[model samples]
Target chain A: MAETIPLEQVLGTWVAALLTLAIFSFLYRDNPVYKIAEHMFVGVSAGYGVVITWREAVIPDLIQPLLDPAAVDLAGPNYVVLIPGALGMLMFSRFFPRYDWLSRWPIAFVMGYSSGLAIPAAIQMQLLPQLHATLQPVWPAGEVTWWMALSNLLLFVGVLCTLAYFYFSREHKGALGVASRIGIFFLMVAFGAGFGQAVMARVSLLIGRVRFLYDDWWMTLVAPWFGGG
Target chain B: MRLQIPLAITFLIGLFMAVQFFVPHEVFQYSFESLLAWVRIVGAFALVLGIGSLLRTHWDKIRRRRRDWPYSIVTIVSFLAMCVIGIGFGHEPGTVFYWVFENIQVPLDATMFSLLAFFIASAAFRTFRARSTEATLLLVAAVVVMLGRVPSALIVSFGDTAVGHYLHANMPDVSEWIMNFPTVAGKRGIIFGVALGAIATALRVILGIERSHLGGGGGGGQ
Candidate 1:
């Protein structure tokens, strides 16, 4: 005999749907029902983050290493991580005006280190080679079609105009002004193509979610009856 | 002392890292990896701060009964409910957290972003008129690329075999080439220039010449 479905689960499902629809109602206009859902979402997300941080980072990365020093091998048992960890904790000290300055060390370290890393890498990887590549192109290896030749020429032209778009040492005037305008048009076309690609990606994600809800979840509940003794 | 110290650190660290990149030493590589891990940890903490602010802002709105206050309440309730289910109940697939995330979050995010499609179409319709030689070229290129992208273009029967295939192959190839070769190359060039400028800026900071980021007095306080 089939088991009767529980009312609680049914109610939970309905609550979930109501909440989902409430949030979606934002597309029409902002309303109070949406605000409650948004606030609840923020609280829950924070709570989730706190839990994950404790489980994933604090417990595993920081605490575990301290508790069993020999078991942890990554950076060796220097009291260094403890210094930053203490500073991170000191950030809470900002709530008390007297001890707030203690938080500055970690903040400074974070800013200093990030800029130190990002600035250099951005120069080397993104800047230099790209500059060099723009100036040169490898000639066709063996045979060449007119189409290929035309494509290469267009590519070179596009690169030049795009580069011209950002050239602001002097005011864009005469030839420079015309070139920059052309560059912007090319950039817009590129962006339009990218925007299309982004739409396609989001569509696939929606389809995947719908499939999980309708096909996977529904089948799990219904499929057992087909093989009944 | 507050801003000056940080600024000084930025300048010195920036200079050091740039030098380290050119040097092929194991010490530099090790330092970089360890530093990278430290930065990642700090970044995660920043995310927590952002979430706290999001909760506070919404809660205050709900409390005051501000215009559109119900939306804030709804948002908070749904958020908290999901978090409890996600964290407490283990946010595995088919669970409450998963159900809400899959059903609500994914759809809402997608739909909001998808609205851009209609906006783009309307904008294109308004702007894509052929007025000049340059405009005509652009319109021609757009139509050609649009047609070439989909398989349905083959069934449109613009002509017989020859001219249509030429349009199909050539226009798309040109568009693809423009994107892959020129557009990419141009972007890369700009990126490189910015990078060099960054290196210069970082060097200036490290040496204490450029201290604008550290505040008005520069490195004098340090």
Candidate 2:
């Protein structure tokens, strides 16, 4: 026996299915259906962002502080918000040419703050870790084998040559040119692998849409209407 | 006042935020968290400006009778509808707003991005001509990875026993070697270069040597 489905759910599936096809219609050519779908996507996403930001961010960071100052663990009623609050307001100064410079203040803050924050984090997270990993023993503790040594040697050489390729101070001539060519090989391999993984991801996404259309839309809604289980 | 004040603010804020990294005291932690809260507040506030710009763009298109102007009506109306519903009734699961999000927005967003797969395939087809040694290497590696990702069991199920076992034994290992060694080495080299550049750029901003952020004349000062 087939279980009865709710009207709202069935209708929702129709909306989802139509919109999915509308979006995929772009693969054919630019059409009104695609354009409407694209526009609706943008608008709906923006609206969604607003509600989410309000619920998760503005309510806690802005409203809550104002509503109950003591709710904040910080000293002095979380007046710290006033600083960024004012800076944020200055972002609107871009609309007025005469005071466009006001916006620069906030821009500078974000840039400098972000740049500063990113530096140490990048060094700690990316540079140091990669360097450290590269410096590990060519052979693992248990695997005292030639293949392991060879792989480790290759990794170290690959990294150095790749770095040499990017070092623009000296022209790539003689040994440097050879190293740079090898660097290209490593980079191509990396890019190729990344691309292959990306294809798998995209195929999986398509599979998702197909599954939704089949199991959810066809079996539940369309089949029921057609008097098929 | 404009140049000096902005640069000083950047230097101080940047230095303070960076310095917080070394400070381990709970008091400093509280201060850091407070500062992060301020950043989040500013970010949230910035979203309003983003939405405003989006609305203004669509509204202008509609007003000017631009190409596909009628579609702007769809955007504006959908935006307004969602906004009114979401803001007024709230986004709880049972609400109309939530239903719209689940049914309409979710599918649209997912399907829209999913279209990139076709574009990637087309791009790959065009680029993988094997005209050069580098291109050949890239194409070969891509093929290996693609084939390797398909499980041997699946391949066997499709009735290719000899190739299936061969791939099952070696393909995955080969793919892993490509990723774990060559790819990682290339990526790490890039990361090192980027990290150094970032640190250098940050220092320049702090020292007031890089003022492009302030706009007009690269923010080289008034």
Candidate 3:
């Protein structure tokens, strides 16, 4: 007996294949089929986001605690959860013209909390660590290769020049102008490398999609006709 | 009263959150976790508002019979169907919702982004002109990095000779050197500037100097 594929699975493969091709059709030019696919993509993405948010955030954080506190390892009916629940409900005030201003409370709370949190985070995570990494000694206390010293010198100078380029408080004349020009060179190289990486990633994704269409979709369609499982 | 209260709330919450970073007390730590939970809950509501706005826009388009109005119906229907199936059946594997996500959403998302490969190449072809010295350097770097990234490019045989072996051994090293040194330097400079700017902006927001988030039309009262 030959193996058999389920009806739903076959249908799903066709649906996926068609959608993939529909998106690819944009390469020729925009058309109704592409428009339909684009619109469907937007709808599906938005719907997916809503469902995930509700299940992951709202249900576990807000609703579950209220309904069955024990389910979430709470010792008692956690009334504290109601604070966020009420704040969330307050967000609906935007729907009404009279109470719309009330929505600002929750918005303000979120914004204030995040902004406050970001201050120490930016300093601790980005500023201190990056500065420490950049300011390393070119020639350490031990034996070092000339190439290592040269590489360190280039990095230190490149960073200083880049910073000089960003310093717009003073006019770029003479020494500053030279540093700025060097800075621009470093920036351009970094940007080019980034662009190359991005192009590679996109190309890899394209290859994966093409492989799926060829290996999965096409094979499923033609395998039965070829007397293969 | 409306404006003042929110501003005060913002300042107090912002200060507390920022200050809690330095505090090692268990109470502060507990409060920090609780506040973060509140933020998540509130953020979910914000997403609801966004989705509501999206639906309203499509609904209006269909009602007005705007250009490509029929397409709006497709969006609305697909959105509702996904929501109904997802919320009703749950998103676990073997469910209808999972099937829709795997077949419909994943393919659409991947194919849509993969199309960018062609678009980016076309864009680069048009804009990557070597008009200036900096532009030439960028172009050269991009080409080198692109070729160097592929292992096969490193193995280019010049009649299967010694030169080919040297090139094969050194190409990846040169690429890695550029990325590790010059790239790191440039990125560190950028990060320093961004971090300073972020701290300043956060402070301004916490102090209520940045009242733009409170919305427009004379709510800028101190």
In model 2, which regions exceed 4 Å deviation?
A1-3, A70-77, A227-229, B151-161, B216-221
Candidates 1 and 2 compared: the better one by DockQ is 2
TM-score of chain A of each: 0.73, 0.89, 0.89
Error of 2 at B77 (Å): 1.9
Tens-place lDDT digits, model 3, residues A32-90:
99999999999999999988887888888888888888889997778898998888888
lDDT of each: 0.60, 0.83, 0.87
Model 2 lDDT at residue B111: 89
User: Which CAPRI category fits model 3?
Assistant: medium
Every candidate's DockQ is 0.30, 0.62, 0.68
Expressed as tens digits, the lDDT of each residue in B1-222 for candidate 2 is 878888988898788778878888888787777767777777876788899999999999999999999998988898889889988888899999999999999899778768888998888888788888888878888877776776664476646677667777788778888888888888877888998998898889987899877874332337
**Model 1 chain B — which ten-residue stretch has the worst lDDT?**
B213-222
Give Cα distance to truth, residue B37, candidate 1, Å: 3.2
Name the best candidate (by DockQ).
3
Expressed as tens digits, the lDDT of each residue in B1-222 for candidate 3 is 778888899999999999999998999999998898899899999998899999999999999999999999999999999889988889888999889899999999999989999999999999999999899878877777776676466456364667767776676777788889887888778888999999999999899899788883232333
